[model samples]
Target chain A: MLKKSGTTLIEIMIALFVLASAMIPIASIMGYGGRATSKDARRILAMQLLDKTLRQMLQADYDEIPIGKNIQNGFEGIALGDVTAGQDKGFSFNISLDSEYVNPVKFKYRGVGVNRPTFKADSPVGDDFLPEETISLNDVVIKLTVTVTWNEQQNLPVSVSAMTYRADFQRRTG
Target chain B: MHYLDAKRSGMALIIVLTLATGILILGISYINTIRKQSGRNTIELGAIQADLLAEGLTQIAMLKFKEIPGPLYYAYIAHVKGNTSQPYSVYHGDAILGGKLDSPFNAEFRTTFQLLSSKMYQDMNVKITVEVEVSRPDGEKYQRLIERTVSGSRRPAF
Candidate 1:
């Protein structure tokens, strides 16, 4: 008579092992994908924040632009929109300005000058001709930098920055 | 009995191999898709940066014109009149192009200036073209051109 034989314990265990090994990589990939999506979302928000802040800085009057570095925490609610219950949360931004001189060649010949008010006789009389090769206060090049920083899930610090130059054009008038 | 047992084990081995191969393919495909998506994001970010930087450079060019209106006007006029030897005749070369600005990624800029008009009783308009090229995080390069025209509020006295 013919008899049916059941699979042994070793065969079942080997099959399970093979399946689990294959699944391990898939599970890890899924985890990595989730984290990557979160990071990308945060990066998008950071880029938007940076763009807005940089536009504001560029639009401001050159003289009125705050010089040196300034940092703002909870910048999202302040710069972006209102937060829940007046809570300041999310990324921080740092803006800085560094100025340098852009020397323009001075001409010996003087053109129209601003009329000066009469001074007291005690004051020393300055030269009628403007000093040659003198740089004006407006002849300056300013480097403006805006950076946004945030901490990721593992408390991993992530930051991005954008910088551009702002020359003191002295173009704006009262 | 031995033949039957061997046949059953062979069937089990085939099933396991098929399952493993299917899963391995799926994993590789998923990883490739993710990599492509990440690369696209990097390109998008690089393009945005290049455009913004170009805009900023345009503004800087406008400001530079405003700051040195007299010299720039003189230079333009000298160029038109074929007087290259005069002081402030040159458009000051690329001195206005502030070179590379600091950023998380690499960026470079090139600028060109055109004196649009110098007619009588009209505003002197200067057209500035700013070309900003940025290298993406994914080893790709992006370029953007921003053009702006700024008019002098008042004619510069040269």
Candidate 2:
């Protein structure tokens, strides 16, 4: 009793409190880790899906290429079970040539509010950027960007994307 | 008795601090994970939209191609929408190898595609390109080029 030794109940409680406090943060981090894992997995899956679609389109004939909002609606007319409409992960595929580069904005259906911004064929806004009329699309260079998003705060929603490009295939002409 | 009281109080403080730190770390981690998930979701949806756009461009081109009555085709422009905010720009080119109108937009991203093929691949092939741009509400811009070159042949009779 004279010599102070062994942890007092008070000290034990204190230690426990500290440990408990520490655990809170750890738990939060763990929660975050779980979500991160989900994102990573989804990213990978999204990439695989995009690649599959691109490859299929590449191999298929023009008519066979599924067009317009149909792909977004899904392989079928409706969305997959458990997958909501807005929740669908979509892909965009584009094929171009030298002529299209001349006026990219006008060439692409999405770009609005301008007639034609004539940039030289070699400048960053011109012809030399994508491989010059490659032997084929493999020579052409195809790009893909996969994005997955979810709402965390308000409706602001956060999105993560992975992008890749396929070297244009050499054009096979008789 | 006073000394003992002080020690216990000190311990409590330490415990509280430690717990706070733990919670902070966890909260941060969770936020990060959530942010990442949100990003991925955006990527997936965007990709799917792009795929449809590419296919649409080709189908439309085919229809336009058929309308033209000759083989030495003229450039026909294909203007499709992208992110939703922008207007529908014009892409005027040959009906066959659909050439571009030659604009002064960012090449890698802002540029659009047109077919320049001389003839169909094996009389059944169809080739078209759709331009996809990845732009964030936060002001970051990326570009995606989707090209579909498909070969077609006569269907077999059952």
Candidate 3:
């Protein structure tokens, strides 16, 4: 009589257990990949929105810059789109104008006004930006920021910011 | 004895099949995630390009003003040459290169400009128009519009 050398119940059970264990890591990798993709997409949108708003400001007229023109806080409120409350987008922006004497910025805040490519102090201002200095003129401060929020539960919002100011000085024309 | 082994072999086959099914489901979900990500990239690229074009539009408007620059309706319109404008297409949103996306957004500006002289400062209200036609690499088209009014004065500020 010819007898077959087939496996028993215990042996087959052991093989399956090993196979499932081996597949665990592969399943985890797939799960991680999905979350990473969503994160990347949101980040890209934030960058684009921020760039769009900033470009508009840059293209504005030299005089149109946010200097003493925060009239009725309109320029300050121009940071976000809609006029009143309940018109909130995913972001909001504001600009404020006051004598550097009221609240001295830059010269001490960010250490700007000295970096290269610095304008030769041509345009005129009201109060002296660097109070310690002699010239007294108006200083324009521009504060820009973009905040992005997802509609998901408890998801933290992301933001990008830009801060720069125009100093007081008259550029002697040729 | 042969019957007992045959049943054990069948049980193992079923277990293996079940695992394969789980793997397929996971694979499909992962692919969906990637596609969603690609769609977002398209919007971001479109937004940046649109803003750049808008800046150009603003500068052009400032250079040339209408006799009666209505601060309400001055802006630009960007669209594909062959096809009319549509809203959003995930496929076509690349405005970085000078491709079809750039072609549709031709510059159409106002002719007359307000001239401000010294002594008499007038409230100059001008309308500037800017349109961004988003062209994506994957053969899609999109457009965005911006309407702005600019008020200019003659005298130097205080």
Candidate 4:
């Protein structure tokens, strides 16, 4: 009888091939996870900075809202001090203001009856002929737009914006 | 006997394949779990930040309201209401507090007070709303709105 031998080299090679195939995908997945986590962390930091800037804007006086062109390193024309040097240090932002008063609408009442008795006389009369109109409310309505820009991973640019409205209304006096 | 040897080798091959597959599945599952956890954490952090900002702005507005006298406060309201075209007076954080930090992040805040209703010889109620927007150096933005209602005497008792 012939003596039985140990496993062949071919078997060892096949086993290694299977193991390598399985490990390759797993390693790639882990690498993907690491990169995603890093990106998310940067995003969170950026969001925090944005929130802080917005809070500062809300604390400002209404009349002092910077309007028209972008205002840099200042709030309402006042120097922001060292905050404006954000670019040199890490981050920076711009605030722009656009304002307009909302217009009120008015409806005119037209007589239902026409001068002529004919049912289809020329044109319809009364309310049918009335036209809708818009009038200015004369109240101050201001829109403040704030944009913040920063860099991610030291290269990619990231930015976020927020807008709010301020309208003037009557105040009661005792 | 040859048939038995062949059967044993086939069994070994199946066992090895099964073990490899199990490890692969587990690793993929773990990675997916980690990814989900990170996403959840980020969202929670954002929500908390927004809430804190809104609360802070409300406090600042309340403090400003306390500092001004009633007559002047009323006048300020009138001016803002009457002049729709011209810009109204606004408080600047750096200017009011002084010695503000020079940070890379920038912030702009707008607070407005609206008189709700009032009666002569009675307390006057006003609604104060604060809007804030913050910008980061990387161009990220966050915004919040805070509102409060406060009542004060038309004229100071003192």
**Candidate 2 lDDT, A138-168, residue by residue in tens:** 1132333333344432444544333333322
lDDT for B104 (candidate 1):
56
Error at A28, model 1, angstroms: 1.9
Q: What is the C-alpha lDDT profile of model 2 across B1-158, one tens digit per residue?
A: 96865465456556567667766766776777677676766555555544443443454444333332122111122111122111112222332233321222111222233434334322344355656454445444444565655444433455
lDDT of 1 by residue, A41-85 (tens): 767676676666776666666665545554343232234222221
Name the candidate that leads on TM-score: 1
Candidate 1: segments with Cα more than 4 A from true spot: A1-3, A8-13, A73-141, A168-174, B1-9, B70-89, B92-105, B136-139, B153-158
The best candidate by lDDT is: 1
Candidate 3: give its CA RMSD in angstroms.
17.2
- For all predicted structures, in order, the TM-scores are 0.70, 0.40, 0.41, 0.48
Global fold similarity of model 1 (TM-score)? 0.70
Candidate 3 runs further than 4 Å off: A1-28, A31-174, B1-9, B66-124, B152-158
Q: What are the runs in model 4 whose C-alpha is more than 4 Å off? A: A1-8, A68-71, A74-142, A150-156, A165-174, B1-5, B10-12, B34-120, B125-147, B156-158
Worst 10 residues of 3 chain A by lDDT: A102-111
List DockQ for all candidates. Answer: 0.27, 0.11, 0.04, 0.07
lDDT of 4 by residue, B3-69 (tens): 7776666455566688889988888788878777765655544344445544644554454444432
Span of ten consecutive residues with least summed lDDT in model 2 chain B? B72-81
Task: Give the DockQ-based CAPRI class for model 2.
Answer: incorrect
